[model samples]
Target chain A: MTAVLCRHFGLHHMDIAEDIASDTFLKASEHWALNGVPDNPTAWLYTVARNKAKDYFKRTAIFETKVRNEIIPESIENEGEFDYNGRIIADSQLAMIFAVCNPANPSESQICLALQILCGFSVEEIADAFLTKIETIRKRLQRGRKNLRNNSFQITTLNETDIRSRLPIVLRTLYLLFNEGYFSKTSSKQVRIELCSEAMRLTLLLTENTLTNTPQVNALLALMCFQSSRLDARTDIRGEAILFDEQDKSRWDQSLIQRGNYYLVNATDRQEVSKYHLEAGIAYWHTAPADDSKWTHILQLYNQLIVVEYSPITALNRVFAFAKVHGKDKAIVEAEKLGLEQNSYYHALLGYLYAQTAAAKSIAHYEQAIQLTKSPTEKRTWQKEITLLRQDKR
Target chain B: MKEFALIFRLTDISDFQPSPEQMQERMNWLGSIAARNQLVDKGNTLLPVPGSAKTVKPDNVVTDGPYTEIKEFISGYIVIKAATIEEAVVIAKENPIFKIGGSIEVREVLKRD
Candidate 1:
């Protein structure tokens, strides 16, 4: 609703749009506390926001005349101008995505802006998601908004070519958002779930649009659905992250798994393959009933993913699949070649692989892993593994 | 309920010009408290350092103010009604100044008999 209002008033009046939105919420809280929530809370908020905007315009005649002459058409002025429908709201949000992801701004700024403005993520929440300090997130948002204003960016539908060129950044932003939600180090599960749902919702918006409904988008959606299906099983009763093999399969959401499969099928319809396609394939294998054959298929998907988009994290994850497919000794040799010794996960994986044959080396790796990681939970897990290795040695 | 003044102390490291998002978040926090009728004063941000400031000394003598020797300075203050000092501390903790490493000193406002 705020995005729509900003679009209507022109992006230059973002401060005004934000003021009206905040006032609407303030009014809602004051009124709802006295008289229970209205039957149609959305409509109520929208009406209050519209009235606030109207009041602002009435108070500033020069600004009102400028808006009338420059932005709003004379003919449309009489047609319930403030009555924004669902379609307009969606388009406004879509335009907001493009506006945030403008090539002129840095990628980090774009993601931060989208998360805060479009997804309603607080500065602290965004900081947690990106593993950065709150001050950094604040600067990113400031620079992003300043760039938008300087560029005279406004919310409007983009041409097909522009959409095609800009779509990758949007997908990348959503991908990072989902990853943050899925593997958040923060204690709050609710925030993580909200992030995941927001990412999925925005991705769904892309899939719904004609210009953005590409193979990569479908594949990304499929990957998110598959990963989300296992969210319940990913954490233990005490909210600690559980290893994939130790998770209880019964807790997985079967309906979401089915939905993931549906999107995966759609993703494969095109001849062109993307990193998302490979990732979705890997995620699908994880949802499938675990067997020796499934591990082989997962390994193949990881290989394809690495070839398509090589990242240090992806390479590290690929080593786990390699360990599953090949013997531990062979996998250790391959992992050693990756030169990721500084990474805690790399040391952790090495410790696990070497625990059976090389007790002293495994203990050393576990200690290294504990030293490298800042996460208390991860350190505790490594300590427990080291204790077990000592017991085995005794 | 007692009124408490939340005095924000700005460290030298603090960002003088906070981003718009930071400003909005601070406003929203204060707005929520105000909606509940707990706010006594919305408060004001102080002028930047090395600016026009004066200190009135003994015998009506005036000098350039804000002791340059001090590393920390009083930036702003907001008064809110709370049932106890603990409640006031909780309110003070919500101020956005802490995000940039500034500190808030909560003091109870004494009432006249």
Candidate 2:
């Protein structure tokens, strides 16, 4: 059923494909539990899917009459590959992805909608995944769907020309989705391993597709591979976060590192200097042979990343890389410019940098970092730094 | 072998009346729980007390039948088979039908020796 959905819908509509498949199975389970098991399971599954799609359309119509215009008629007459009834919607997943990624809607909304509709996740689950409220997710999805309808966004297959244009947004959405699943933003007990795996699977699909084999895609894939290699070491026996430097590097999946390196090399084949290229390069540099002085190489990549995507977090990372490549004076200049006390990570890094300088204010910066950080792990790490700095001052 | 009955008493507060749906949900949850533990023999809700007048020896007095200052009136309860007060108290923790500002008072039923 999932394969059929993939074949019909496309790779992007993962949420929808999973939803329909799950719904079909749930119906099957409920029916078989109540009555005896059906003789023909596949036909029964299709019937259930058809009914679900119909019900969905009816519900959509009932909720908003405006959407009635966009509703695909259930009539089997002249039904082709796009028909949801007996004709079977070929590449439906891709169609759904393109619809969600439609330029009419905001990028966040597109990603949220894809997560909700294609990925079969409830708004609450997505909300938990992103550390946002359920209401916020609902609103975003509502706005996104409305935009999709308003724009009348319908495209079957993306061309090479447009794939490059759309691929970054697609990659970013998947990357963030994987991140949320890997490290759930909420205090939920279980890590959403399925979401993370699904995101990687989708990225692999893009990588395999003829039109989408761009350098950016390769870079993103590389980044995901490198990050995924450390998934096991991210959480300890108690499921608490482990610091990056403190992680057991021996436990890191060597196979994933090799794969990441492979993609990283592929990403460099193109001339364009995308943020993914720089970010993946940085990841490769970290996971490379530790003894090699790759700091200069990494510092250059960070500089490029900063130029492309100068977000606060990126800037913070850049400062650390600069500190490694250059000396404390150059690093401190960049750190001070960021107003370290405001951002916890920035403050923590500044505290470390100041401690290295053996300055009197290092303790103050560490204290500021400890106060600013909310994460228990982060706070503990910073507090330790503060203690060391204070002892050094003595 | 010893047989003991735990008589659990409860009161319904009028201001804390739950909606019909909420009441149904609470009742369903409680019913399932009681059935699972075989604690409930019977339970019910009584309508509000009516005003009544009674003639005394010398003077006539007119007041509500309940004769209580507290808002809550004796609502309903279930009979439980328990060996001791400690056991009955443990059962009380699992009761799902406790509404706002309501309390359960459990007492040992005296068996004639």
Per model, state how many residue pairs clash: 0, 15
After the best TM-score superposition of candidate 1, give how far the Cα of residue A44 lies from its true spot, in angstroms.
Answer: 2.2
Highest-scoring model, lDDT? 1
Q: CA lDDT of each candidate?
A: 0.80, 0.65
Q: Which stretches of candidate 2 lie over 4 Å from their true place?
A: A1-23, A32-44, A51-90, A155-164, A181-184, A187-195, A339-341, A356-360, A370-377, A387-394, B1-113
For residues A314-350, could you state the per-residue lDDT of candidate 2 as single tens digits? 7777678767766777778756655435787777777
RMSD (CA, Å), candidate 2 to true, equals: 26.3
Per residue, candidate 1 scores C-alpha lDDT tens digits across B4-45 of 988888776347677866765565456435534467776677
**lDDT score at residue A44, model 2, on the 0-100 scale:** 80
Q: Per-residue error at A390 for model 2, in Å?
A: 5.2
Off by over 4 Å in 1: A63-80, B1-113
Native-to-model Cα distance after best TM-score fit, residue A378 in candidate 2, in Å: 3.1
Query: A339-368, model 1: which lDDT tens digit per residue?
Result: 677889989999989999999999999999
